[model samples]
Target: MVTLGLVFAGPCLVAQQAMGAGTDEVLQAQLTQIAAQHHGKVAMFAEQLNTGKTVGLDPDKPVQTASVIKLTILFEAMEQVRAGKAHWDEPIVLKPGDAVSGSGVLMFMDAPMTLTLKDALTLMVILSDNTATNLMIDRFGVDAVNQRIAWMGLKDTHLYKKIMKPATEPMPADQPKFGLGKTTPREMAKVMERIGRCELAAPGEPALPGDAAICSVALHMLRNQFYRDTIPRYLETLDSTEEGSGIASKTGSLNAVRNDVAIVAGKSGPMILSIFTYDNQDHSWTVDNEGEVTIARLAKAIVERWSPAGIDGKTLVPGLGLAPVAGGGIGASK
Candidate 1:
């Protein structure tokens, strides 16, 4: 049975004065209420773009970054192109060895296929294509990717290897292999800030030589993130029916973890948020109540608190089916 422990850590509200006076208290209170109910650790960071005010719960705590690491890959790939080390349209062939078993369309394809660098990137982000990711990792060595992270002044973020590769296969036994990359909420948000400001691949350096074109492409890819299915639907209320008002974000989930990070363009300014949850209680990916509810409840609470007016009248997203547990009831089951 899945036991639910809901805890709200409350918002850190760091650098609050810059964000204005009353906002910090409200955010902190809300986050605190949310963190009190959970059993596992939750690390999150939210930054208001205009004032650069930020808040977090264990913001610096390192967490297993699932697909979010792809953002780093995307940055490095674009930087390579900007430096004239590679071309966006350059043709590359996909071989059998590049295929990985989970989450992507390429593994289903059977023949020696080819795609341009730009197309590969599109597949990587849009579909979370593992095959394409491995290929890119091969092209740009892991060392190069980590070098960029260091240059950006992010100490807790690093890319160790490809996610699709199994740890037991051929690589050094001592090497970490559960995921391709890892990062803390604080570090991840910093990268998002850099990308938002177009300072990632600064010109005339080892990465991208002062070429704004490269930065422009990177920005476009982020803005066009393919996975829109998981963003809390309530946030959509503010969005125009034609032009959704919500932000572009990514979702990552594995056996024992689920994560969502967003760059929200709010009324004040853009905000970068990274929420990570890890549960060791149940490692099964199939249907572990403890693990699923922990993440679902947290995500729901965030959406509800962040946009309470929008969600008060609506139903929770279908799968979660989490209504408030009145009188300690289990709420509605899915």
Candidate 2:
């Protein structure tokens, strides 16, 4: 029997906050009330890029990441392309055995079809395609993704295996605890911050020149992410399919868990929100799943508190207008 009171923690668990003076105590109070009212455990970390104001609940606590770990895979693909190790146009073949049923269109498509590496990656992000995710893992290797996570100085984040597949190597003691992967709210937010800032290289490493192009493509997929019921539920004003949205996000879900990490191009500045909910009593797979709504409420409160004027999609197109990074020719979404 599962319990709703479990609070997963890691050795790195410590109070993490940098809210400057005049911090929004009311906003924090609102967040606390929202978390307490939910029928599940919540962990979150959010930061405003311009002011560095932040609010968090168990920011460093490790939790089941579900499909959210795909962000690391997407990150690795970007770095590999930047490092000349992989090409976006590289061909990837998907046989019948590669198809796995969950959340994607690839399983219903004809088998043995060929797709470019970029296509698989886009599906992995926009649609959360499990088969597409497996193709990427097979091409790049899961260990490589973990290596990149380590390079980013994220200790609690790990991509344990591919989607719906068994691990062939030795398993960690906590393998069964977090099915596909695991991460802390703070660590995952760090990943989004890196992409938002277009800072690809690891800390202290010489910056990779001409790598802003890589960030553009990654952001493009994230901006077009198909699952919007979480963070984007109350943030988007226009149909993202037609006009594009100011939110670039990736969401993950399980029966009792829902997670979303996003980079928002707000009116004031860019903001990053990483939220995870677990031990939820509501396990229904409906749009109104309690965990999902909980995440959206948290996001709405945080964004409303910080960017009272709302988000600007225009800033998103130019890579959040981040310094030393500019626009690129991103392929149109299918």
Candidate 3:
């Protein structure tokens, strides 16, 4: 593994060297080279779900989340349902004053509209809808969300405030530094892993009878996510809308940053890729944005190296049918 210097702000974290069967010196070298060539700083972590083989670059460095933080909100919603704090069909009102600017059609919709909690969550994940996200934040307090994140054992991950709105409560000293939220590549990847594996309970707690059902709902929404310009750019072969892509992902973008976190069900096994690029020179929102392309390149390289036989879309639904590891039980694939 190569040791590269951080050219951007914040403490430098050494890139995590590849481990287990996924530990290909050539692959790690390629990843380093790709990161070095990019116009911005890059941080990523990828894990093969079945074997626990992993690879990463600056995986522990915290960075701006942009819309990627929505994943946390979605996770909290799932937990709420599991605890009977909320229900999927619960009615959620969207007042005219509630709508905020930036990504999503809900803001453009008529004022005082009523939608189900499931509808709001679907919009939040599939569209990266800022309005839907804010609605969720309002429904689920910011403090509650952070508590959920802490419960996950993530130290650096945090959701600071709602999209396009001011933080009502006092914020951390560095809240302005990381816009909507912040999280390390590894932490965000862990969140994705939990959803993929359907381990909804807190550590050591047994999963509820409906945990798999809730996870299926979340995974289905992610599988239908509309933004595929980043990680799925090159690796996807089918129309995700018509025939679901083997990948379940969420993307976040800013003028100078691009992020994507995904669970790819490959022929080899299920893998998680959490990638972030920041302080980029190319800020274009086009499909060819340098940061976007950089993420795509990185994902393509990792997926190809890890799953040479390619991915299978059929494995993504019904709890990812994830193969059991040493202690975890097997989930038969649909």
Candidate 4:
């Protein structure tokens, strides 16, 4: 890797490199180059669900969330369902005013279309439906979402407002800096990790508080996501005939920002990858946008270097991390 008198090594990596054990030179170098290829800022965080091996490039740096913030809304809804405060089958009415266009079928539908919270959640992810996303924010209040995030102990993750709407209340000073919402890649990766573990619960492994069923529903919806232009772009299994290997991911994009958070099933186990790019010079919404392609290539590289074979439709144990590392820090650049 091109170490400019300093390297962007995370805690586990730096410690391993010290013991002459970790630091996959070739992989790290490739990852560094991938970040450089983007004409904007990039941040990434990945963890081996089984071994807990991690990789980070500016993972802790806060960045624009775009539609990725919708994940928070989804999560809060899941928690509410678990707490009996909400139901997936609960009906949500879509009025004429709810139609705020960008990405979704709501605008095309007639006024007062009805949909269950479950179905709306699915559309919000699969289609990046701005209208459904706004409906969700209204049903699940913005304050509740922020409170849930705080209760989850995620300081850097915050939802600023509903999509395409003015903020109802005062927001933090940084809200303008990160559009719609804000979160660090590392924090988001941790959230994805929890989702992966929750979905991978073994039989008779006493159900956790959140309920594995909730996790299963969310994962299934993510797997059906319509946007494959980012992380899953260059993958081979996507072209397969059978529903063998599965990938549960949520992708977010703006004209100048692209982000994807996913739990990719691997032969060994699931890998959680959260990557974000902002201030991109290329703002095209095309499938082959440079930023989108960069994320896809980076994802391919991580999977190839870490989980290279077949999944065989088997679930592997979740490995948190091999060993504790020294200090962990994020790398920053102008």
Candidate 5:
């Protein structure tokens, strides 16, 4: 790993070397500007697959992942299938008891219904569906998910059970608290890299019955994510004529946080990026609209800045960074 000097200093200086030479100054400047503009702690990580190079701002700082942690749930579910503890095609009943009050279309359904484990997983990842996630988590067992997190060697990531309903207020001591997921930008990127490399399967582990076929199935499910419907809409300003170098991405948000992570097909190879912003004050449903637009804009700007023609190797400092002007629109209210 190459070390980069910080052109601008402060708390952002921690882990500065993780970004490599010449890039640290650029990232520090970007983070300083973002922190000033948004009045929030913003951490980001981007890795170039072709070169094994990474650039980040507060890369290891732990923050709320919001719905982005669903990706972990998605991966763990796939791993369970690989271990023969569950089946992708197994039927799961959508009873009222399974409902969770947060994001997703599944929460609006009236009658109890049935869906395959595979379809539920799709809805969970593609739509960031909370109801689907809760049902799956209940079935898979929250303890199992945490076990997988430990098994995967993620230090600052974990699920604190599952949130079933929107909080009217903080809960009492004995009542079940609404458990949300938390992680740092760097840890999230590691999980994405693992998925891209098809390394979700534990090594030296025997393939359980019916598990061998799951690898392709898991890949297919990820490839067919429903969020694709919103990417073009969000990234409309991007030069789409450059065919075949598309991106696979997921966006997550809460009241004050906005985030997006993607694996971009670059000219040299795939590039992975995870950008997270927290404590954003632009919460208006009308002024800021959906936070997704802002998040997408950030993503586009990072890609443009980091790519060959984007920054010209010059560092982006305070008052000197590119901003994403447009992209896919934000999702409707959760």
Candidate 6:
């Protein structure tokens, strides 16, 4: 449901010739085919930040956020620090009640341990730590987080409860509609955009001098993202940290849902993308799960089609980054 103002306005208008008309035609055709052939629901929103060329496919449709909504928590944490309501270096003691399962090493560690609020935020984003998330949520106040979302003028984004909260805990009747949290691809993309632009903090709250403070921390944590099964799966600079521009992203995965939003530093400029897959029939958790593979392929296709200039010429083909390699050429699969 993204506006798709330029993509659908009339001609296949492009701000710059990153890629030509013929390539854009093929790319749009492939995206259409991808949406049509996907096994379940798919929503995406992408924009080249400088050029404003864009694409969307059901980008406004509501979807289960899985762990992706932790971003709101991250934003709120940054806000709290800026407001002096919380301190990033404040000490937090881990208790038995704080432990929760799924996608984090915190649960496996000993309880009654201690870490700073900043450390918890790091684990929350980099590891998707449910316990770290819940700890920070308690400090950040769940309602306060939602209020900030509304204040920022986003409607479909909301957090329902702490990660893996019990059924006995008080929550709204619609909690079942979106587990943990919910958001649209477009909304999530905007969140990233604000964070990237360093505009997430409250107005007049002394901006964090040029991505050196909160903005840098948030992006650094995202750049260290441990999960690479989706968005970064196809980028040329997946492993080596220094050779090429890196992907800063957060990914969420549930059995039936896989979502990722990222800010890619393209060779020419920055590009933002958000993609979500849900209601998927294939719920396998394998590296080759259908939904995961779908997102991975779609991400690569978008980059190749729209920003051919950004593509690293020596990288492997779109999805076969791990295939045995010979010195073929730029797009060589093996």
Which number leads on TM-score?
3
TM-score for each model: 0.72, 0.89, 0.91, 0.83, 0.73, 0.82
The whole-model C-alpha lDDT of candidate 5 against the native structure comes to: 0.60
Number of the candidate with higher lDDT, 1 or 3: 3
Model 3 CA deviation exceeding 4 Å by range: 1-22, 322-334
Candidate 5 global TM-score: 0.73
RMSD (Cα, Å) for all candidates, in order, is 10.8, 5.4, 5.3, 9.3, 8.8, 8.7
List where candidate 5 sits over 4 angstroms from the true fold.
Answer: 1-17, 21-36, 165-179, 203-216, 219-245, 286-294, 305-334
Query: Which regions of candidate 1 are displaced past 4 Å?
Result: 1-23, 166-178, 201-213, 229-232, 237-246, 280-334
TM-score attained by model 1: 0.72
Error of 5 at 158 (Å): 0.5
**lDDT per residue, candidate 4, 1-334, as tens digits?**
4322223332112111111133355675677767765677678887765665667677777888888888888888887887789999999999988899899888789978899999899889878899999999999998999897787678899998888888888888998788888998978886777666663333455565657568767766776667887887766453321342256678888898999998777666567889998878889879889889989988989888888883322222222221211111111111
Rank candidates, TM-score, best first: 3, 2, 4, 6, 5, 1
- lDDT score at residue 151, model 1, on the 0-100 scale: 78
* Local distance difference test scores for all models: 0.60, 0.84, 0.85, 0.73, 0.60, 0.72
How displaced is residue 51 in candidate 6, in Å? 0.7
* Global local distance difference test of model 1: 0.60
- TM-score result, candidate 4: 0.83
Residue-wise C-alpha lDDT for candidate 6, range 1-334, written one tens digit per residue: 2122223322222121123322244655576566556677777878767677666666677788898898888888877776678787899888987899898888998889999998999899988999999898878778899999997789999888887776445777667888888898889998888877678555666555433366666766776677877877877553434332256678898888889998766655567789888878788889888888888888888887667766432222111121222333212233
**Candidate 1: tens digits of C-alpha lDDT, residues 198-269:** 664454644444555565455445544555433443344432223333354555666767676766544334
Rate residue 134 of model 1 by lDDT: 81
Model 6 scores what on Cα lDDT? 0.72
- Per-residue lDDT of model 5, residues 1-334, tens digit only: 5555443344232334364553535644554454434434466787766566566767787777777787788778878776678888899889977777767888798758999998888788767888898887878866677688888888887776566545444543423321377777888888776666556557776445544345445434443345432222343334332221145556677676777676654444456778787766656543343444544554555555555443211111111122221222222122
